[model samples]
Target: MVITVVYGVLAVICLGYFAGIVIYTQTVGFALFWLLTGLLLCAAGAYCAYRRKHPDRLEMPLMLKSAVFTCVSVGFLILAAAGITIFMDTEEEAPEDLDYLIVLGSKTVGREPSDTLKLRLDAALEYLQENKKTRVILSGGKGSGEDWTEAQVMYLYLKNAGVQTHRMVMETQSTDTEENVIYSLNLVKKTDTVGIVTNDFHLCRAQALARKQGKTEVYGIPAKSNWFLLPNQTVRECFALLIEKFMGNI
Candidate 1:
């Protein structure tokens, strides 16, 4: 009875932690993590119940118990399949050519680009350098902590990097990714084909949203995130994908 009670308590804690991850994180990776942890707790609860019914079976020895645990662990393999499905369904492929390059915004630390934002900016610069004829649109709004809008910061960054001001369009009123596409699209001519630049994990949703907003020819140019940040970011993106799917927002 004591063992059962202990396992029950631990199981509840594990479930609560999983719930917290879902509520706080936006990525698909968190969902996969919680799903695996929940399955483990469930298995532990089942094991406790089974032991209670056959206490004398303990004589079967530790080796047999280890084997049972190993077999039970295979359930997590299903989670991998689910994760892959979620990821693949959201990914948007890039087109061979584009007329406009749209750069999405990341968080700014007081008017300056944060490291993550810098990576995005740098990627956009590289793309612009490669495609000299493409017009660039920088989209972002001024948040509470920002000294200036994200578009303004990006404009300055690109200009300092030697991109001519005439080739850049600044959309400075969008506060989120969806808004970024919507607001920036207004600035693009109807005949133009757009290429969106954002973090690699975000490309899938960003492209989907852009298409929904009436972009006939859209492409994605993905920027890589740092290794340590990937887990959290991926988890957040999974949730974003799910929400977009549920609401038909993508």
Candidate 2:
């Protein structure tokens, strides 16, 4: 009964988080993960209730139990590895006087930066202010329902923030992280010491993607994430890291 109640509470929390994310972000994205997890928790709770009423109603075959255990074990291991990787570089600092700093783009609202993207931009702005010689590549294409290319939005934000036009280079054609690295790298030599700016939860994957594309001196400059969204975003990044590994992207 205790375990059953715990599962019920967990299910409600997950489902409520999912609904809150949808309402706040106006997009589903990986909030589906929360929805699915909530449903599975509910099912598990139901099973526990049934087992309480029928203690010996059914027993699983040993072989089938072994298979299920193996699957669960493997899944847990994968998720753990991905979570570790997602967080490994969250506190990294880029070496000074980098040849280029790549600001990977996220969503923008109309002509303004999204909260996530603004964090990246602010981080980049701070770094660029201190390291005036480093040019920045604002990388991202127009995503669905956005008012302009993400790169363009970033460009205008930094410009108004006092970063000169010559200091900003726009790679406005890449739609995702891999493409962000690929297209941004094309604007400079692979041997260049580059820094990638992104939210803290995304630093590892962004740095890994740069290294995968033959960058030898790349590093990360992590921006703070929105506290309320950090858990959801980090869990989503773990899945993304696994997929990127499966697709040979990082």
**lDDT, candidates in the order shown:** 0.77, 0.91
Clashes of 1: 8
Q: Pick the TM-score winner.
A: 2
Model 2 over residues 1-250: C-alpha lDDT tens digits? 9999999999999999999999988889889999998999999899889989998976567898899779989998988888887878578667788999999999999999999999999999999999989999999999999989999999999999999999899999999888998999999985678899999889888888888888867888999999978889989888888889899988
Lowest lDDT 10-mer window, candidate 1? 74-83
Question: Which residue pairs clash within candidate 1?
Answer: 26-236, 27-235, 27-236, 27-237, 27-238, 28-235, 28-238, 29-235
Write candidate 1's Cα lDDT for 196-223 as tens digits: 9888777778888988987857877877
In terms of lDDT, which candidate is strongest? 2
TM-score of each: 0.67, 0.93
The per-residue C-alpha lDDT of model 1 at residue 112 equals 74
